[model samples]
Target: MTLEETAILGCALQWPDESLPFLTEAGIRADTFSHEIPSAIFTAIATAWLAKAPGGFVGIATALGDRLDALGGAATLQTAIEGAAQPVTLPHYAEIVKEGHSKRRLALALKAAYKQLTTEPTGTVLAAIEAEISSIAAGRDKARIQSTREIVMSVLGNLNSRTDGSKMAGLSTGIVRLDEETGGIRKGGYWVIAGPTKGGKSALVRYIVRAVALDQAKPVLVFGLEMSSDDTVEAMLATEGKVSASRMRDGTMHEMDFPKLQAAANNLALAPIFFRDDVYDLAGIRSYVRQVKAIQPDLAVVVVDYLQLTEGAGSADRREQEIAIVSKALRRMAKDENLAVIALAQLNDDGELRECRAIGMDATVQVTIEMCEDEPGARLLRLRQRQGKTGVVVPVVFNGETFEWHPLAHEPEPASGKSFNRKRK
Candidate 1:
């Protein structure tokens, strides 16, 4: 093993509390070491550290357990400590390890890319290069294990830091009760919005987009699988301008409508939002998000305008199974990137999420939209949050003219012949 690798490993084996944190923060994983022997030693040290194993070479031995002989054993560990560098310059050694890993990765990638030059298509060769560079630039961090105590303490700290009137933990969902009950759409959350045909699925998402975009000025991204790019913009224009969508569609707006449209466009331009109406397949969606995240890391939320439209891998599976694969992928992406994703789903005639029950199974929060029984122009959003509450119906009225939603005072009571759609006081 290299002297730098031994020093780093020795530092970790000796002063795990001090050096392990740095090693983890510096993105040092077991594979970062060039040789398998050092890599095995490093892996054991990390396992012991996270499990709160005892200090010194004994701790490393304890972690390795029965498999100690498979590695260089306790005697080789002695060599590591005998050649140990002081913990003060651990950061420098860690940097060397990272640099060496990058160089190796780059050289290997270039060799493979060169081979592809003759055999593969131009696009395939460029893809290989781009993937490698992106990987190198990302410097993927191996996760540091967090104890339950640490997690609860973090929750406590977050709650304590909130201002007196801070109701939500993430972006506002535009409904007061929904925000208060579920703490809004959160980072690393996967939300499923399901509804029947013409049941305000698009309208609800548009309301959230508007709330996040123009209302809060947060960066938002929308993948309009079912909606055209021009249609998405046109709908936004009508909604923001408070112009009748039908009139806008029919091109029958009065002369004064031009100024309103212009003003709405001006207002929308203030919000940093992107639309990928052409992205349909899963690879395209993931690639676009990765590219955007590389440039704009603080991208708040991603909206998939109806999930059932997008094509995914595992295409040979049964239709329902394929959809389940897609749903799992969407959920995985949100968790991997620490991103919030809202995927709209179509409901069957029986008002259940169509094709894949996994869509609801994987969602952190699932909301189903149903039209109000008595109020023709309004819809009720029934929320079933995995970690929060269930059996909560949020009444919302749709203003078709401006393409907006207003919260109603209470849930509808159709049995009593009272369907209230009045705005909440």
Candidate 2:
């Protein structure tokens, strides 16, 4: 048995109540211990504690029952007692034990990756490795038991970090009024943008991608499930360059449109917008994010072009549960990765979400687009916001030809079709 694991187990049995919290908080479970005795002992002690049994030998044995007897019971208990350290050092020993566990898991992951390399795609293998390593790393961030003062102080610090409350509190959405109302797209936020077909949900995502990735120079990721990566980029070019989509689609662009397309492509070539339309499952999305995050740790946004198309953990017949799983995972991923996750959703003609309501329940902010005859264009309503004001309406003007959409107050006119590469032949 590793000394650290044995020592930590000893500490837990000695003062189970005091030590269990630290061990669990440090991400230590039975699996965390490599050795036989330590793992069993930790499990037994945990079982005993959960049953409200005493921390003493008899109580733990009663709680763990056959578990202890199967592991050489009293003799093992005595051995742990002899090796026991004080609860004061529990945290230190827990850290050491956690490190050992991570190393063990890392080795296993590498071996598995190696075995699969001959059969798996290179990117798949790499993504698995990346996700496994990231999981290990995340285990180190122990959840703290915070006092009210500590919680308040943390909130204040977050507020102060903004530097100026007069501006949007989070990453800017590039729409001024929306930012003022909803405080921009917050880090660790799960935002659901819902609309019927051709209501400009995808357009909004593209606008945000361009705003954050190009204008703000922040990294952005997009998963366009309905469109291929190349086609998505062409669509972006059409909107951003003021080139006609039909013309681009047919390779029939006029002479003047060439520079505009070239300029758009040039701007996009190096911009930190990573697009992948191949991913159709949540695991793939998670793996892709983990891989991208390694390089761009500051990646700010993730857009799932439409939610219903993505596969979740459930079976084909259980669509609702599957969507719930997908929705919850997206929200959790946003929190875990500290980025804004914008998941577009399909809406019915009556403006209800086409699929699961769990999408809205899991969202920090949920907005839907609808058209009103009295309104000049579409109306985007903030139906729900967990952290801010709701029922706010933003007037939207969308140019279907240009694929440009924005709140009326902050709408920038469509690109002027200006030619670039002056002084050329």
lDDT (Cα, 0-100) at 259 in candidate 2: 95
| RMSD values, in order shown | 20.2, 20.9
- Candidate 1 per-residue lDDT, tens place, 66-109, comes to 77887777887998898787889998898898889888888987
Cα displacement (angstroms), candidate 1, residue 350, comes to 0.6
Residue pairs clashing in model 1 are none
Instruction: Single out the weakest 10-residue window by summed lDDT for candidate 1.
Output: 416-425
Task: Report how far residue 339 has shifted in candidate 1, in Å.
Answer: 1.1
How many clashing pairs per prediction, in order?
A: 0, 0
The alpha-carbon root-mean-square deviation between model 2 and the true structure, to one decimal in Å, is 20.9
Model 2 misses residue 244 by how many Å?
Answer: 2.8
